[model samples]
Target: MFRNIVVGLSGGVDSAVAALLLKRKGFNVTAVFLRNWDTADETGKCLADEDYKDAEYISKKINIPLVEVNFVKEYWHEVFTYLLESYEGGYTPNPDIMCNKNIKFKKFYNFARENLKADAIATGHYARSSFGPYLEDYKPGAKVKLLHAVNQKKDQTFFLSQVSQESLQRCMFPLGEMMKTDVKKLAVEAGLGVIAQKPESMGICFIGTRTFQNFIPQYLENKPGNFINYETGEVVGQHQGIHCWTLGQGCRIAGSSEKLFVLRKDIKTNDIFVVPGTDHPALFSRILITSKPHWICEEPESLIDSWTVLNCEYRFQRNEKLCPCRVYKSSNNKLIIVSEKEKRAISPGQFVVLYLNDECLGSAPITHAGPSLHSLGEGEITSDVDDNDGLLRASTV
Candidate 1:
């Protein structure tokens, strides 16, 4: 058990409850409010100030010491820059994943250990962590194992997959085994009514309520492009920018009775290819290639040399059921995942977290998606495109 713990309080009921629980458990508890974003929202109001006020109020109510630290520069450089660049390069990057890896767990954990002199850092993240065998030693209880939270609906293991194992060993998730409903009830019973009823934050932490289209243009130049029909090769509509759209996004194709979805984006031509209907064949892919993966503990022995078949969830949040898949390595050392069933919207830049039952094995960033071998009727898959595109335009053989 940890003797001293610092909880990253974000002016939310979850963090407040975590701090209270840590205090009740007799661990030295201190609440730290992280100021990772200093920009004002669309309404010209600084959201961080409001969050700090709530955090201060909660700390006073809970009778715990509160500290505020700024990580704005770190976040802007490490997380925001990558996010904008990924979109500019026609990929949908997950900033939350990067934020956890670079800021919350890495930067905040270091500060707590060095400055606060804390034994471990805690957060309201709904993911469980336990000790396991080290990756290199294979000695039992030598490493940390990241697992899914008990509250499956609120489980955040996917976003947390990128956290380093060393940081995870010193990290505590107080809400791991508690449901969101129970946390709210506990907060109210503990005389924290204001925070108990507060609504959960949505969208990116810094962007707040502003739309991505409005916020992105402020950072990168928008290049308008034609919206082409994938099947007929006809330009049916036009878009303000290809970066504004992502794979499987519903397009309001002017004059079309049926709803159209983005099937692919040709970066060289600056054209977005669309197909009619949400369940278009082009939207589903059976093959996905990923960049070098990072394992939480160790890569399973079954996946080391030969192709190993495993059950995985392509997008865990939307689709809960596991999809059977086989994992292999390419000559270039990238991972190749072949799903038995077609997966919808296997977008580049999103993460594909692998799991064995409840334990999170590791994760990789999706770099390419193509139609399954069975899905192709005649011609073989072609790679006749620039590598900068970051996605393969799936076509039938």
Candidate 2:
């Protein structure tokens, strides 16, 4: 039903192939290059200039008009600000999720419809939709399910869990059924061989080559704190900032050789608790509490029913395998998730994406993970987890 399409062409292999595929399908395709990072502040040179030049060449080769738009200010306000606040508050936020929600789907979607008069905005993401790759069955008031891409290794649906249903109905993922290797092969066949040779971009773009510790300090204050051993409650070391460490991440002590991992962040006390070794029980959490969920299409019927709890599959990180879990609705719209298995380093501030097989139900930002093996007694594994400060039965809470 829709024809005019604006593809996010970043000169990368995936996007080049995406634009090529849509253009071959006889749709009017426009390549949009988004400049989100401003390198003038510190780098002195424009880091994204090379990327734009490649995009220009790719668009010309594909015979599509290329338009460059600057969303540097929008990205800072929408994605970067949230990242700083989450870190300062002792949470490991997923800015990639927010980038899709606020910038790519929201800002870019709007720009395409308003400026370019496109019927839909397409992305190079390895994800699919129940409405078809081109959103052929999309309707104004109907719900659309976000399905996983056939290539699970390159699946990006987790990053799009917070996407609104409206934007989803107007979006297309051209790489849904294509593998990374296949995408590169197609790019090479399209005479865009250089694009296929480009290295895949990872993590936050503005940080570039700098380590997390090095780049974060430039924006956040250096509030030093003590690193206490969770088991001994003894000050093991000091850190420049609690924001620098995340749950389950490694911690190094000056002059000490024992490897330690983060257990918890006491934001009020300004202390980060650590335990020696990656296999420490103190690093595993069996239960997690989350903020309100944002369902892309509609609330699952069972969730909306009077049923107090329902079983589902969930994962915090994209690479982590989904775990069977019981979901409970707590007071104030919070969700209590009892993971069937002990999850290592379930950090607060992470977005927990829920799935029912291949379809993404929704996602919620993690607020707390608790009842670590260190705190629970042996028999409490099942009973104690259900009675955790009365939070165990979130449906009643």
Q: Each candidate's TM vs. the true structure?
A: 0.90, 0.95
Model 2, CA-based lDDT: 0.86
Best by lDDT: 2
- Evaluate all candidate structures by whole-model CA lDDT and list the values in order: 0.80, 0.86
Tens digits of per-residue lDDT, candidate 1, 1-397, equal: 4678899999999999999988988888999999988888889899999999999999999899999999999999999999988998889898999999999999999999999998788898888876421112123457778988898888888889888987888877888888999999999999999999888987687888878878888888888899988778988988888788888889887887778888888777889988887776667766778888889988777667643444454453323656666666544557777666677778888888887778888888988776632255422333432121322232111
Residue 224, candidate 2: alpha-carbon lDDT: 92
Clashes of 1: 2
- Candidate 2 C-alpha lDDT tens digits along 316-378: 999988899988775577788888898899888999999988899899998777667766753
lDDT of 1: 0.80
RMSD of each: 5.0, 2.2
